[model samples]
Target: MLNQIEAFQPLNGASRERYVEDLIFRFEANDTTSTEKKRAILMILCGPYAYVMIRSLLTYRPLNEVTFKEIASKIKEHLNPAT
Candidate 1:
């Protein structure tokens, strides 16, 4: 199933929202309901650029203490282009 989901490409002109949607789809496909596992999987598969971004965004607290929603929101917010 790992083969089905590609690593997120935040630094490659990819649509962050679309990639997030795809990731959620993959999660649903695999019946992955645990937010802890979701966060872990996201950290593993979100690529190096995103890992750095997430780390910076979450510096106020330990990564393991964050919820998936917080991580998702932070990633989405951080990757959005300035208008």
Candidate 2:
């Protein structure tokens, strides 16, 4: 699947909101299965710099300590202050 794409870079804050929407649209359009969806979502959440930031938030605890669900929840809360 990846070979067909020209390039896929990790997203940052500048247009991350739009990036997320686009990712969702692509995933849904492809009819991704639950497991594949979870894998793709994890890749987004665990970008190259994410572990360091998540660790700082957790005071340097082992990354295994935080489940992906917890990470996603924290991210959602951070992104949607009004919620």
By lDDT, the best candidate is 1
lDDT against the true structure, each candidate: 0.81, 0.50
Q: Which stretches of candidate 2 lie over 4 Å from their true place?
A: 1-14, 44-46, 51-73
Please give the lDDT score at residue 4 for candidate 2.
29
* lDDT (C-alpha) at residue 6 in model 1: 67
Candidate 1 runs further than 4 Å off: 81-83
Angstrom error of the Cα, residue 52, model 1: value is: 0.6
Candidate 1 is scored at a TM of 0.82
lDDT of 2 by residue, 5-47 (tens): 2222335554444434454455566675565454456555455
Q: What clash count does candidate 1 reach?
A: 0
lDDT score, candidate 1: 0.81
Question: Candidate 2 overall Cα lDDT vs. reference?
Answer: 0.50
